[model samples]
Each structure stands twice: as structure tokens, then as C-alpha cells.
Target: MAAKLIEGDPQRLGDYRLAGRLGAGRRGVVYEAYDSGGRRVAVKVPHGDSELWRPLAGEVAAIRAAAPYCTARVIDADCAGARPYVVSEYVAGPSLRGAGRTLAGPDLLHLAAALATALTALHEAGIVHRDLTPDNVLLGPDGPRVVGFGPVSPTETTLTWPRLAMSAPAYTAPEAFTGREYGPAADVFAWGAVVFHAATGREAFEGSSLGTVMHRVLSVDPDLGPIPQPLRALVADALAKDPERRPTARDLLRDLVHADATVRLGAPCLAPDCLTHASPAACLPAACLAPSGGEAPRWAQEWTAERLTAEEVLGRRVCLADALLVARAPLTLDFLLAAGGAMAARLRTPCDDPGLGTVAEDAYVTLDPADRPFAPAMFLRLADGRGGPRGTRGTEERIAEAFGPLVVRAGDLARLADPALPYAWPRLAGWIEADRDARARLARDRLFWLALTTLLTLALVVALATRGGPV
Candidate 1:
């Protein structure tokens, strides 16, 4: 519910007239306003001369590009004005946190799916909702609508002090605490926490102090006893300490929708008479061949045979012998690798190419001689400038035709990788270990202070008794 606007509040901004205050935060106040057409909208007016207005404008622009199914549509914005403001479709309902009851059965499922769908749209548009919490989700009449979409500094302190001094510690990912850049994976972690709270009516991680909450988030596995099956497993995966192990938003949506087995990848036809000249594999989509089967599609089997034959032939070539073939976009390669079912060995390239003596033991060799540092190796180049695969089919179809076995071998690996992590973990481990030690030291210091305070209180009582009442 919106509170009546008070003194000093702007009644009008641009073409909209503010009616009441929706909420207020460090960034600014959100007012319930109406546009020239009298359409109710939520207007966020940043505090005077805030640097955040620029970034907020950028965020609004990015969000405007996203699908509006489960998100509040951005109506308008004016960052260049004396009083910059952003107007969005006003979601008139209580936040998920204010729902006041634990969601169960279909309600819980609906919430999860809706949130995932919203995230998929944002991620597809290359936007990460860094502040996805229960409070940020509005339980609209239509359904759950994810609202706030922008960056929130993890280190920012709140007036709430010991309880929530650090920004949403329970919902924040482990990587965020280690000073690693927050990505879409962090939002997934928050999604897990949010869903867990909705299901159980308690935070996935809870602590009396910020330090304790941070420790739990960084090192402790969340208890999934209260959450029901399937969702429990999904939430657990989302809350994995390692961000790389978490599923993409699209993967989450697919699982929730139970569409993995039925969804088919369609390939575009090169020509009307493509069937006469090229093999059926060149025209038909592989997913259509074995839509519901446990067995790999015929095209996938053929692609596997082709890939093996190519690899064997390439093995004879001295320069290509040890290199892993990319064959598709770097995102496809990452999806296959992270799926953890790919047959190809992981390679690293500290140097430009293996041809140079400075190359690491496991390095990539691309068909394109242009030196690309740490670029994934390509095998059967999907794109050959003519009216063949690249011209006729999409990347997914081409990848399926070329690395079909690898794709079918790792079924879920076909999903495009958005918000992909860099292929390196040596430093990640060190960062986690160091953060753990620092947290441990902080815990010890807190305990020492607690013990010291208790001892001092005891000593004071004893001395006061010995010295009599008034001393």
C-alpha cells in the first residue's frame, strides 16, 4: 500500500503526477504516480544529484528490452532532467516477503516457474537482476512479478546494523562475499533462497549477526528438510557453493516446465530443393528424429561418427593432434563442458597458441590462425562461407549436426550459455579458502569478546558485593 505523499515531495515529474509514496531506499523514493493518460505507474525518483541515476537509466533501458511476461514493464524515464525519474508499470500487491504465509503445492511451483521465466527473459537480454529477493518480488493479481532490477553494492551497510548490515547476506551468493563480480548465477542463488523462504517461511540461512550469516552463506550447505522433493533438489543445485555448478535460468525453466524431453530444435531450410542435392541430415533438424526416445537421433549418431572420423584423421596431423575442436560458438563449448558430460578434455591457453613454445600442456588450436588468447578450439567449422550449414541452419542446428553426439551424449548441454564463467578455478579456490580463514578469525574474535564481557560482569558483581551496596 502506498502512503500519502508528505511535505517536500514532488507532486509532479515530467508528465506524471505523484500521488503517494510506494517505498523509499538509499537510492531514492518510489512514488505511486499516474501518467497523462491516468495510468497508474511506480515512479522512482533518485535522491538529489545521485550518481546512481545514470546507472538506473541504463538498467531501465536494458530491462525495457526484456519480455514483459513476469516483470514490471518500464514505462518511461528521464535521466537528463533536473529531477531524474523512472516510471514502471505499478504492481499493486504485497511483496512476496509480505505475503505472510508459506507457499505450498501448486502455488510454490507457480512462484518458482514465474521467477525463472522472468530471469530467462532478463538473461536473454543480457541483464542480471542483482537484487532478486523476496522483498523485490510482488505478488501481483496476475502472478508473481519480479520488480527491482539493478546492481546493489554487497558491502553497503544498513542502519539495521548487526541484523542486516551487509546487503541481503542470506540471499547473496558465496562469490559475492569473496569480492568476485556478481553474475546471473548470483541471481539464481538468490532465487533459490527466495523460493526456500516462500516454501518454509524461513530464510535458507539465518543468523543473529551479519558475520554468522555471511559464514553460513559462504561455507554452510542450506538445510532442505522442509522443502518438498524435486524443488528441494533444484534449490540445492541453485544454492551450490560453486556458481559454475548452478543451472542457467533457462535450464531451471525447462525443468519446471518438464519440457526437456519434448522440446525440439528447428533448423531453417537452405533452399526449396535442398532435399535433392544435400543429405537429409543437411536439411532436417536432429531433435525431430528422436524427440521422445532414450536413444540418440540418427543425425546425432552420424555426427558422432563424422566427429570421430575427423578427430582420427586430424590426429595424424602433427599440429592438430592434441587440440580440442571448438566446432561451435565459445558459449556452446562452455555449455558442453559445464554440463560435465562432454568427452573432450578441458584445455587451457595461457599463451596465444600451442605452436608457440610458451603454450601450456593442455591448449587449444583453432582453424583460424588469428591468435585468440584462451579461445576454445574448433573442430568441424560449422560455418563455411558458401550456401551450406551456416547459411541454411542456426548455430544450434549446425552444432547438433557437427557435435551432435557430444550434444546428445550430454543432453542438457544444448542450452546456450549466458553469463558464462571464465574457464579457471585455481584462483577461485584460493579466494574461498582465504575468505574462510578470515571468517574463522572474525568468529574467534567475537567469541573472545563475548567471554571477556561475561568475565568482566562477574568480576564487577564480586567486587560490588565485597565493597558493599553503594560502592
Candidate 2:
């Protein structure tokens, strides 16, 4: 992947000389570099202002924490100058996505387990990867090594803003998008997405639209494609909408390790070198051990906005908006569909409240796209105005017809939906309204303080002049 450094590429990042371009993304440019001692490493230089470089300290700490478990150790970092840079051990391998080779069977299991182990280390240190996708994983000669983990601002939206460039909407956890309390469980959810992609040779819930991707992550089950047996079930559990229900990274590592052990114990090596004893690497073929050693066919691809197709550009925009909008729209027609179907079944038998229908009816208008924020702008472009009725009545009726006759259990209903389904809409509205109010209050407070300070300063000056002191 080495190429001559072109114009705009920094000649030196700290003491390392930028030799060739490793990769470039929205956030930063990665360079294949060598240090003063002639040791090879990767240097990532942020492209924007001081605000973008502020998160580097936290990112560096997280990377250092993850070093013990398949993460490249941070070698150096400098934030003193106008441009900030971080140098980490350069892993010479293709990313899991660009490996250009199929990863399934035992190889896939190994990679998944390694990633889980890495995440376990990271989570134990109280750092969420936030953005863990196939592109971030480097399959080195040893195993899968996670590289990118610095300065991804959850609120940054600009593509030129290097602080938050690694946004993968499909791989993002449901709680993350909803602005709910997300923790290590969110990283586990992304782990499932990565495993799905590796097993199926395709994105788990990829679509032509960001709305489509969001809906799938939030409401629809992932198309696991032809993933076989136990692994499919494991992936499904990881993709569970309820964060608590998803297994811990340690739990995943153990399960994968156990599964791998079971297979090894059951099969005896047929190698003629020795029947006495053998390690997994000693017996397995070199091809099986190095599943990621391959070449990308499109090696000469350049990073440019003009090269991006319309669909690709839109997807990027959606990702950027998703990252920026902390308080998203409260309701979606899809959310109403699932909740309405459950509500209808409950109405059949009398509960404490017979007027539940009225309550549901009252909340319907909020489901309209006009009330929503982040996603509506992007989705509206895809929908024509002449679709149908604007309110939730029409949508509820459609959902009721689809699920009312069937025996739908609450567990089944909540599986594809977020566990905070009941409070999501109301809480979403509350967060958005509260944020607006807080901003207004802060603005007023600033002005009031400014006026008070000015008055106090003038009074002091008058008093000093009357006392014959230097004014």
C-alpha cells in the first residue's frame, strides 16, 4: 500500500517521517511512517482545528488500555502544535473488510473471539469503542488487531471534521442512536455486526438508504444470510435490542473459545509429522491460520468526494447526522406499528385501563415525520408527499391487520424493538425539549451576568474617582 507522498501530505508527524499514505478518512490521514530510530509505525494526524484535537487524550488512554488485547500500543502523541498527531504500532495487514478473502468456519470464530477479548480489555478500562466496524480491524500475522481509537466526537457532523469520521450507522447499537444509556453492551452489538459481515460476505443490515439501515437496526432482524448453526444463534443474541440481554465481551470470548476447543478436541490432526502432539498452528495449514492475507483488487482507489456515488454520499450524510444529533426524533411510524400490534392484543382482555386505546391515539400525531428531527430530513427526501394519510391512524390500522390475528408474544415483540420501547418516544421528546430550554436559559444567564458585571465595574470606577484614587 506504500505510495509517494503527494501535496498536502505532512512531511513529518513529530519525529516520524511520513513515507506513504496508509489510509485517509474524514477525520484524519494515516501515514506509513518511520521514527528517528528507523522503526516503522503508523502516524494519524488530525486535519482540523483545536476542538477536533481535544479528544485525543481520552482516545490515547483507551488505546493504551486496549494494548494487552489485540490492540496496537500507542507509541507517541503530540498535541502541542496547531496539528495534532498520534503514533501507534503499525500493523501490516488488510482490514477485515478489505481482506478480499472469505472469512468463515474456524477463521471467523477465531477473529470474533479475538475481537471480543480486545473489547473486554477496553471495557474493563471503562472505554467504549463507540465505532467498531470491519474497517477498523487489522488482521495482522498474529491475529485481529484493532487500530483506530482516537478523537471520534460523538457530536461532530462535518465530514472534514477529523474528530468523528468513523461512523457506521448499520453497526451502531440501537441505544446509541436513541440516546439511551449505552455501555459496553453497545460494543458487543457492533461485535455481532462485524461477525455477521465476516460470515456472510455482506453487511448484516446494509441498505440503499440510511433510514432503511436505521429501521433494520431498530425494528427488523438482521438478514444473517447463510451463517451456519450455533454461530448464527450467537450473532442473533449479540444483535438483541436489549443491551442487558446481550452477553458481555468476556462471555462471548469464552463461548467462542469453548466452541473452538470442542472442534479441536473432536478432530484429530492428520499431519504425518507427528501423532504424539501438536499446536493449532503447527497442525493447521498456513492458509487457515492467515485468513486475512490477500490483496484488494481496487488498490488504486483514491479518496475524493467526486468519486462517491449519490447513494454513498447520502449514506455518509446520514451517518454524520446520526452522530451529531444527540436528541433524535421521538417516534417513527415503524415504532407505532410494532407497539400498536401489541396494544391491540392487550385490548381484547380487560386490564386496569380500558381507555388504553385513547392513550395510544393521543400519541399518534407525534409519530409524524414533522415532529421528528435527525432522521426525518434524510427520509423525507426519499418519500413523496402523496404517499397517504399523515396521522398514525392509517399506519396503526395496517399494523393491526398484519399482527392482530397472529399469536404475538411480548417477548417476541420486544426482541426486534428496543427494550426501552415504552419510554423511548416520551423520553425522546423530553430530551429534545429540555435541551432547547437549557440552551435558552444559558444564553439569558450569560447576558444577565454580563450586564451585572458592567454595572459593578462602572460603580467601582465612580467610587474610585470620588476617593481621588487612580481611576
| The 10-residue segment with the lowest total lDDT in model 2 | 412-421
**Any runs in candidate 1 off by more than 4 Å, and if so which?**
55-59, 150-165, 259-471
Q: Model 2's lDDT to the true fold? A: 0.57
lDDT of 1 by residue, 208-277 (tens): 9878988899889988888876678889999999999999987786455431111112233223232222
lDDT tens per residue, model 2, 1-471: 545567887777667667667787655778777665545678888666856566557666666655365677778887656778888887767788877665767667667766776776677676777668898988776567776766555344322212221258778788766766666898899999998887877877778877777778889897775676557778889999989899987667645543543455444323433211222234433433334555421311221213443234334532211111111222222222222222112212112321112233344434545433432221221122222222453443343233232112242121101111122234333454565688799999999999999999999999999999998
Q: What clash pairs does model 1 have?
A: 326-377, 326-378, 326-379, 327-378, 327-379
TM-score per candidate: 0.53, 0.52
Measured over all alpha carbons after superposition, the RMSD of each candidate to the real structure, in angstroms, is 30.2, 26.3
| Model 2, residue 46: C-alpha shift (Å) | 2.7
Estimate the TM-score for candidate 1.
0.53
